[model samples]
Target: MTGLTHHFLKMNGLGNDFVVLDLRREPLALTDALARAIADRDKGIGCDQLITIEEPRHGGDAFMGIRNQDGGTVEACGNAARCIGRLILDETGKDAVVIETLGGDTVATRADDGNITVDMGAPRLRWDEIPLSEEFQDTRGIELEIGPLGNPIMHSPGVVNVGNPHAVFFVDDADAIDLERSGPMLEHHPLFPERANISVAEVLSPTHLKLRTWERGAGLTRACGTAACAATVAAIRRRKTERRITVSLPGGDLTVEWLPDSENGPGHVLMTGPVMLDYEGDLDPALLSGAAA
Candidate 1:
């Protein structure tokens, strides 16, 4: 753990940034405390998540291990997938690549428009799959509220598990709500056993929606890819928007599409967005050893 210097790439998708370390060649024993130090903005690289590119356990191009800013390991990350996919595609000179995560294998392809589209795989809609504390016969709208009993500020959020758990509250105006205050409370709601990502969505039209998200472990992010996919599916399920629509987040826009179930098999959610490389640097040994906060 001491005297270790790791090369990392700083990347972002719609401003949800990450500090990516390639562990495929030289493995680093990454601990939770070390991850937190690496993600620290003041003392470390500062990112929403710390991404490690490891040798694929499954039959894929590479494995993506994600650690939130809090240093907790999570299952999936849509934005991180696209970023890693782009790196793999560029490294291997391939049009498409499969990135493995704890959630599943996500397929990222080079779109004709020069963006990356990630197949987030099939969403889990069942109550147990989303794994609510109690069983709600219908998950489209659950009995959760944010205010007084009679008059609540928010209620009946549509829940979906796209890679990870999410609850989308469709509202008239997404910007009107103070997510900074409500996000943390909702993310730790007792109903969500494993906690959840909370999103406030406003349907602008059949093809467009505005959204803001309180990420589970990352707090209020400029953009959250899985949240976008979850919101799009929830909107389509509620008949509020078309299957394919543009979701505008605080950082930028992402296109999400929920393909219908057909003869091929179950449907999958696709998220397309732009990725950017900000910079690359080496992690200081003191930071990794928790000597620097």
Candidate 2:
């Protein structure tokens, strides 16, 4: 080991785990092979993602950059932002933090509800932006289907990209279908060139929703922050809700609110959720002792 010197922190938001590397000082880059080697559970310190902190582009807070275990780069990760914010707070003793992502800016606030609230910026809902293979007139409900459940009439989905691409299918039952089996097919589906996170959502009422997600590169995550935001916006656009809602996932719940911007402000989404301080440790060389450079 070169003793390249990496300061690592372990954190999770509602069981969505992460391994954070503080790189704001001297930005470091990970190659595809290096990322895969680092994400290996047996040969390396296991993690759903490898996060790096960088200097912020906007005027305030810090930036959180993310790479999946599979070595894929994505715009934003909601849970990771919360964990990163907590780490920044612990170090700085600040109540708020502004996190930067490839997608945009997200401002985080520690709420009395024992969780963090992040203003996740506005969602992108254009056919070309979502980058579906074909241009569609309507994105609220795109005509992409899956297995027995994805046979058009049985499975019509709403496609939206909240930094990362997502296809949310409104279902009557969250457990009635198998997401693990179908997530891969839809994520790598021909439509999404950048691939996408597949989400199954059930709107219980005007302000309550339930969901299960198959994240691109990450597999079936207990909870996904952007998935919740996508579902809420899709539901609202579909006339299923007003503007705000509580989305329940296997991991936990996150409150999503879409607020109108001021005359000079841009519209944005607010996602409030919790982040946990998991045990932290360094990556013992022994863990990746067998990894080839």
Candidate 3:
């Protein structure tokens, strides 16, 4: 915790912000407590997640490690991929780079218009893959609900695991529900043993949808790229939308496309969006040592 301070980049994808540390060169022993301190809004750097760039284990360009605000590690983050991709692309002058994560490796390519497009691999639709607590014949709609027994406020969510588990409810109004209240409840529901990201989506048209997500470890998020991907895949499976669509979240819009299964391979989900660099600074020694708060 002593020595030279570590440098970090503050960035966001539609307000789903992160504090990124480059651990590939000068590695730091990042503990859970330190990660929590960095994510604390008042006492620390403050971000939805803490990201680290490390030496790739799978021969990819770099490995992206994600830790939620709660200091728990999880696999996959689409927004983070874009931000990291931009950094790698800028560093190497490459049009694309493969970002390795615990969930899988995603190929991030520079779009013609300057946006970044990440191939988030394929969505996992099986019950066991989603890792539901119990078996279900179909994942298009699962038997789970909230509210009174006879009448529920929300029910039958389309469950899928883009990188992590998510249950997306098709709702009449995306903003009507009290996500701050219901989100935590559904995220911890028994149906999801590993917990889940809860989302309320309203289909605007065949190619557009409005969404709000209660990210699993991060709580209510301004935008969740994986949730957006999950919602689009679920929507397409339900015949509620086309193969490709624009998903608008509280922070901004993300274009998500579900590539259909072709002769070559299975379908993959593509997410394209903007990334922003807010600032760059070194971490305070006190903050890293648990003395800042």
Candidate 4:
């Protein structure tokens, strides 16, 4: 760990916390234990995920590597992208940036509306893409019913992979359910070996929705970027919403467009939102050491 220096930035996208580390020039190596150690709030600088910006690979403007609090790597993180985009822009003084993540290449544009628009790319709805345990001819809606909620009430979920596996439960009341209590169960449900982000969403209109989430690996979060994108896709599939919709999460509202590629539709879903800088600091060895100890 010699010659190690970690400059960190604290930021949030609707309260989905992140510890931003600039590794583009420093090239820090990350391990799960190290990630956990640094994410310890009481003993270390806490965050929901650790985001490292490194040299781009395969012809993207920038590259972002995301690790969950439990020390697992995940494909997409909406809030972090905006924050990282701003960070990169501040450093490079550019308005738009293309970065690579484990899932795929995503485009982020710093809009004048004070919102950053991230091209989340087209959603993958095939059974294998959602990567369900088995095959489903039509992935628009699959079956999984939790009793009491009714065997048929919540039976079918419109599944999709918006960079990460997601199962959306379109409910009538986004607030009626106890997300904090139910989120952990659904997130780790056997159906998704990779685990999944659980969303309880209520459609306010064809172009509007309200959502609350229990994010896989991160538990109940104020906002989940992929979840919003997935929900929008699901809503469109069910004919509940149009291609472009306003998804309101606990953190705030995100403008999500499905990008159908039709003459009147979009080719890439655009997620427009904001990232706020809460603070800035560096990780001290003492903090990580204490967490590990």
Per-residue lDDT over 1-293 for candidate 3, one digit per residue giving the tens place of the 0 to 100 score: 55447899999999999999999877888888889989999999999999999999978999999999999999999999999999998987887899999999999998866789999998998999998999999999999988899899999999999889999999999899999999999999999999999999999999999999999899999999999999999999999999989999999999999999999888999999999999999998878666423
Per-residue C-alpha lDDT of model 2 across residues 147-254, encoded as one tens digit per residue: 555354236689887888889998888888788788889899899999999999888999999999999998988888888998888888898987888999998889
State the local distance difference test value for candidate 2.
0.81
Candidate 4 residue 250 C-alpha distance from true site, Å: 1.0
Q: Against the hidden reference, what TM-scores do the models get? A: 0.97, 0.91, 0.97, 0.92
Per-residue accuracy of model 4 over 1-293 as CA lDDT, tens digit each: 53345788889998888998878776666778888877777766889998999889997778999988888999988888878877777777776788789888888887867778888887888887877887888877787765575443455777889889998888888898877777787788877878888887899999999988888787888888989999998998889999888999888888898876767554667898888999987778665554445
Residue pairs in clash, model 1: none
> Which scores greater on lDDT, model 1 or model 4?
1
Clashing pairs in 2: 146-150
Error (Å) of candidate 2 at residue 272 is 0.4
By the TM-score metric, which is better: model 2 or model 4? Answer: 4
The global Cα lDDT (0 to 1) of model 1 is 0.93
Q: How many clashes in each candidate?
A: 0, 1, 0, 2
Candidate 2 residue spans exceeding 4 A from truth: 2-5, 25-29, 58-60, 93-95, 148-154, 286-292
**Residue lDDT tens for model 1, 1-293:** 67878899999999999999999876888888888888899988899999999999978999999999999999999999999999999999987899999989999998766689999998999999997999999999999998888998889999999879999999888998889999999999999999999999999999999999999999999999999999999999999999999999999999999999989888999999999999998888878767433
lDDT of 3 at 90: 90
lDDT of each: 0.93, 0.81, 0.93, 0.82
